[model samples]
Target chain A: MKHTLSVLVQNKPGVLARTAGLFSRRGYNIESLTVGVTENENVSRMTIVVTGDDTVVEQVTKQLNKLIEVIKVSDLTKESYVDRELVLIKVTADGSNRGEIMQLVDVFRARIVDVAAKSLIVEVTGDEEKIVALIAMLKQFGIKEIVRTGTLALGRGPKVIQSGKD
Target chain B: MNLTGAKALIKSLEYEHVDTIFGIPGGVVIPIYDELYQQDAITHYLVRHEQAAAHAADGYARATGKVGVCMATSGPGATNLVTGIATAYMDSVPMIAITGQVTTDLIGNDAFQEANITGITQPVTKHNYLLHDASEIPQTIKEAFHIASTGRPGPVLIDIPKDVQTMTAPFDYPKKVHLPGYQPTYEGHPGQIKRAAKAISEAHRPVIYVGGGVKISGASEEVRALAETILAPVTMTLMGMGTMPADHPLSLGMLGMHGTRYANYAVTESDLIIAIGARFDDRVTGKIASFAPNAKIIHIDIDPAEIGKNVRVDIPIVGDVKRVLQKLMPMLKQTRTKEWMEKVHTWKREYPLEFEVTGLRPQYVVREISRLCPDAVVCTEVGQHQMWAAQYFSHRHPRNFISSGGLGTMGYGFPASIGAKIGRPDETVFDLAGDGSFTMNCQELATAVAYDVQVKVAIFNNGYLGMVRQWQELFYDRRYSQTKLSEINFVKLADAFGAHGIRVDSASEVAPAIKEALAVPKPVIIDFRIEPEECVWPMVPAGAALNEIIDAKSGKV
Candidate 1:
């Protein structure tokens, strides 16, 4: 099972390493992780995707909460939430296949961010399934290179993961 | 008031009311030492080694329930404290370790005597800091102390650069700490407490399993009260030895590997296990699937992660042990089970702890010491002697028996005894040590002598690392590789260090030597020559279930 956790921690030096080190030392498998400052400059939010059973994931959440810098941990996997990952794919393009690639990108609502003589860089943002589908479709055109940002998540509606003080 | 960062550090310690420090001076720590020399509020004990300093601080914390503090220079000095820090971390002892680091600019340049201490201690410490500015001294020190001594107390380190120590800063100690992420749950949930109380009241064969958390939370009285009120037997883990009186009728002594047979049996047969302040460690829960298979476990610990880390927990209450016990006490109904008590008593009578009385046995030495100094604080170094001490010595007060329960550090007892004596000067202190373990930090005899610390050490002088040899004899075809330890004349070594020394080779001479050593005003070491191959009995072979115990008489499960 996969659990996406939203962790709020103090914006201090080595916070990332401390959080990452825990996952490695405890043998928890991390699928994807993204960290950035939240609305409050003093606090940072880490969106981590981990794979474990219910018991192991519960232990992981509890262990993450034990770190002194981690203010709060919210598992958004079960909740009604929104998640997105931005990926840029460079596909081999020629006069014949360029139109098909552009047409395919339009259908997925993706943009051709960069164009070169031999490749076209398509930028797309969606959930994991959509990104995987886009990459699979672009594979026919031959993906020259690809880069991806880790999965970022947030709860739906008005609910939010706050540090109580904020 | 404006002061140097080093002075600010000392001032912050004074604000925390720290009366003593265990530390060694080094190049990077010279500025801190210079400031320490000018202070009258805190007395610093110059230990022979950095590791001993940390262990001594840990002993002091265990004995006094205060946050222990140790300091060392960077690089080698800081690295030496790693084992002691890990030891304290594993046992959840409240400790602050201050290490001097190289200048901030040279931190990543590999300057001489520089080390990334905070990075090195990340896993072992509850939290750590690497201060680049002198102004952060007061706040960092306060936070370090608060974090170290709070819920699930553990070691915290502050690595201060040399230039930061020399920098000037305003000395203003914060009266309150604002750590958003570090608040611990001190109160148990009302619904969970009710459930636990209901389970306890209805349990016919209930057992209370206690751990070091009881001592750390100062819940010894509460634990005893709960057991007595419920008419339940109490079994303590090794770290929880002194939390309940060993002579109490309900007391089942220790449980787990090398634990009393009755304690293990009672737990194995228990219908309800009210585990207070205890994590179901592998040693305590051998063959986890079969450990207390019939019992409904109620685990109460300050650390939530410990609740179901091992065995399945029925009711988990994440709160301080003392507070949780208090909340649950009012909801409980006193009940008795005469049949269950009788069964436990039968097992106790059948499997009483015993050893041969023919030779100068290590058990005999520990038993004699317990008989002579009933109120004395006992510490033990790792190996066979540690298990023997745990088995033979009767503890009646919290913090009275301090040993390396978790990490099982080899040379913990001797230096720890020095700190224990310093913390509680009125009580007699003894380090029940092995020849191999004691030799690791015997150099601390100089610190003990110089400070007039009257700590008595009883060295069970067996020629081999007896515990490892026992494992080999039992399971490894008696291939005792690298277990033999060359003997040293401890009496001469003690004399050389300006401490009293005595050697006793016979069982008849043990008591008299202990008495003589007690009367001596300074540190004393007694070398008791015993049977070399004597193994700690009542053994549960590694990975064996608690019920599969091998007794000395039967030599079989």
Candidate 2:
């Protein structure tokens, strides 16, 4: 089972390493992890996508909560959440296929961020499913290179994972 | 008055009511040591090795329920404290470790005596900090102590560079730290407590499974109350010894691998298991799939993470054990488990913990020591002697038996005894060590004599690492391998360190030697020559089920 966890932690040196160390030590496979500064300068939020069974996910969440730097851990998979993955794909394109590639990019709601002699850098942003579909369509065009920012997530609607003092 | 960072650190420790610290000073931490010299409020015990310093602090913390403090220099000194810090962390002992870093400018420059102690100890510590500004010393120290001593206790580290120690800052200790992320839940949920109490009252065969948390939370009395009220047999983990008096009718000696036959039997047959202050460690759960197969479990612990980490529970209460027990005890209705109690007693009678009394045995030595110093705080290094102490020795009070339960660190006993003695100077402290384990950090004998910390040590000199030897004999067709030890004159080694030493080869000599060692107002080491082939009985092989325990004498499973 794939589980997405939104972890809020104190923005201090080594906190990220400590949190990551827990996963490696427990041998839990982390599919994707993205850490960034939060609204509060002293706090940071991490979006981690982990693949494990129920027991493994429970242990991971509990262990994360044990870290003193960690403020809150919520299984975003259990709730209605919005997840986004950003990908920059460089696809091989020549004069013959350039127009068709642009048309496909438009169909996928992506944009040509950069243009080169034989390739077009297409920037795509969407949920994992949509991004995967776009990548499948672009792979037919011979992908020159691909880079992705791992999934980042937030709960939908009025459900807020508060970080401030309760 | 403008004070240096060292002075601010000292003031913060003073505010925490810390009276003693253990450490070995070096170049990077000289400024802090100098400040320590000018103060009389806290006494510093100069340990021979930085490792011993950390172990001693751990021992003190476990014995006295106070946050143990240890200090060390940069690089090697800081690295040496890793094992001890990890030991404390594994056992949930409250400890504060302060290390000196190279000057701020030379931190990442690969200068002499420069190591990133905070980064090195990140996984091992509950929390850690590296101070860049002198003004943060007092607050950081305050936070470190609070974090180390609160909730599920663990070691916390603070690494300060030499420049920060010399820099001047006003000392202002915070009245109360405002850590929004670190509040520990102390009270159990009312519904959960009610459900747990109802289960206990309704259980036909109930068992109270306790652990080190009982001692940490000061819940021994509450555990007793709950057990007596519900007529449940109490089985404790190795670290949970002394939570229930060994002689009590309801008490079953330590459970799991190498646990007493009756205790393991009771756990196997119980219909309801009330686990308190204990994480179901692998050592205590021989083959988790078969552990308490028929029982409905109720787990109570201060740390929420420990509740269902290892075992599933029907009712889980996340709160301090003592507090939760107090509430649950009052709500629990008395149960009539006469038939269940009688069945447990029959098992106890059928399989009592015993060993042959023909030759000099480590079990005999531990028994004799227990007879002589029952009230003394006892600690043990890992191996056969540690299990023997846990099995044979009767602990009557909480915090009376201390050992490296989680990590099972070998060389833990000697230094831990030093810390235990310093924490309670009026009480007697003993470390039961194996010959193999005693050699790991015997240099700490020098630290004991230097500080006049009178900690008695009894080494079971079987001439081999007996635990490993036992495993080899049982499973590996007796290969022996690296388990054998070369002979050493332990008496001379003790004498060289300005401490007393004795050698006993016969059973009759054991009592007299213990008496003599007790009378001596210095650290004493007694080497008892025992049979090398003697193994701990009622063995449950690793990965085997709890019910499949093998009897040593009859070879029956």
Candidate 3:
């Protein structure tokens, strides 16, 4: 199974390499990973997508927490919180198919970021469900390129919660 | 805070008095490497392989009684350091492995090159770091070094992402660190120390069983002082070599399957056994129920978990070996037991380190190396030569003999010797290896060549995995069972990696090979072929008591 995890850590040199090194050495297939600053400057949050046994992900979480740099790790797939992913999709949309693509884009509320001779880049933001639906609708137009921010999550009904700092 | 991370690392090392680091360059690690480069305060060496870098760092840590640091890039570069990290972890050498990571956004998008290195190294490392923010670097680094160098010291992995590296953070190197759950006991409790001293002072015959912790914690002098004060015989674990002079009057050599006769005799007859820094591994205490049968065992160690791990402890002194000895010294009454000393002397005279010189001898190779390097720090890979070095080398100082004693890891000698050399650069470092054991990690020769760290490797080139072969020959009715090994040309292999290499087939050439190898001031490998049947003598048959050593096939016992 593939699982996406959000981890908060003390941003510093060597932290990324050590985290990545762990997955590879253990032969865990890392499907995707994204790390960026959180609301707080001291903590940088990572969105990691990995394919492994259910048990392996939990083991990885425990091990990740053991690192001095890692403040906390949450298996977002199992957590009840607000999470969103932003994906930019470049689809086939020239004069011949422009009208049909625009109607579909309007329904999804996705914006056209860039327009080329035969392709239009559509920016869509939602959870995995909305993004997957948008990608499926654009499949007929052909997907020239696709880029995603993976998933960043925040626990619901928070009081300015520090995800793993507690 | 940059100061916090850097200072934490430096402060933890200062506790160990570490003076050096070995690493290389990369994008993510620039922040750290830059800090180190600008600091003339701590010496940093640039080595070739990230793997070599880590091993060299481990060598420095083990040799110097300090924590060693090595750095590398993200993805493959960081992954390359895994083998060396595992090496240090297996051998219990304190090392901190640092690697760079991709910027935050590139982390999970399959963007560019990035790997989850901390997860990869978790099993092998004592602790690790995956710093998400730039500010926590110092505190994490300090924690890494602290966890690595304390208790059963092992490797710690720290991964720093690129963005965090570039982020501006207040760099305040800490002079002290506050780790809530990480208190290490350095002094044995006063009550336990007094009880132990009373036992030693009251015993009719006493024995001190010393192990690697003695050498690691620099308690040899204190151990010897305590032993002499109590007038007890000393038997060293393989790791305990150099805990006290092997040739000391009270020293009874090594104790185990192939331990010296005097060491086993003292173990068998003693009324009180003082085990300091030594874990009672199965190899040392063959049949636990029968080991030191007549003795009341007093166990002293820094790790509370190890106090009663194997053998039951009559008195457990939970503290550092040196501090425990210091406290116990004043509490004990000094004595000169002439009769017990006389018996141990007799055992030494009878079953000496005597082997027939007619055939190719592993002991001869070790003896020659020891002859040239009276003060050399000897490390060994696990096998026949490991036992030989433990027996043949006359270790006079503490922390001079580094080997994988507890775990008995095979590829230990090569890298551990590198660590020992880095620890004590003034003293020559020699890795005494069996052919089978040497081949396990001979790739580390590149580490030596990269840093120009001089380490001499004397390969006891037996055609088989000598230790396993001996067990099969003696107990399994010569069912080799894949113990037979392939031929490896040591000179060619070492030369392939840009190291000085030689093959010595004659006994007379032993001294010359070691002397020439030592003179080059670079890593050198010397291979010595010996008869396959050659065994480390005073062999205790499997499942037998300590004193029940076979001595040899013909029954010298």
True contacts kept of 1: 0.74
Clashes of each: 0, 0, 50
Model 2: residues >4 Å from true position, as ranges? B554-557
**i-RMS values of the candidates, in order?**
1.1, 2.1, 7.2
Q: Write the per-residue lDDT of candidate 3 for residues B183-210, one digit (tens) a residue.
A: 5778778887888878887888899998
lDDT of 3 at A163: 49
- Cα lDDT of model 2 by residue, B111-218, tens digit: 898887888888789999999988998889888999998899999999999999999988778887878778899999999999998888889988899999999999
In model 2, state the lDDT of residue B432. 94
Q: What is the TM-score of each candidate against the true structure?
A: 0.98, 0.98, 0.71
The sequence of per-residue lDDT tens digits that candidate 2 reaches over residues A7-67 is 9998888888888889998899999999999988888999999999988999999889888
Between candidates 2 and 3, name the one with more favorable DockQ: 2
DockQ per model, Cα = 0.76, 0.65, 0.05
Across all candidates, what is each one's fraction of true contacts kept? 0.74, 0.68, 0.06
Quality of model 1 by C-alpha lDDT: 0.93
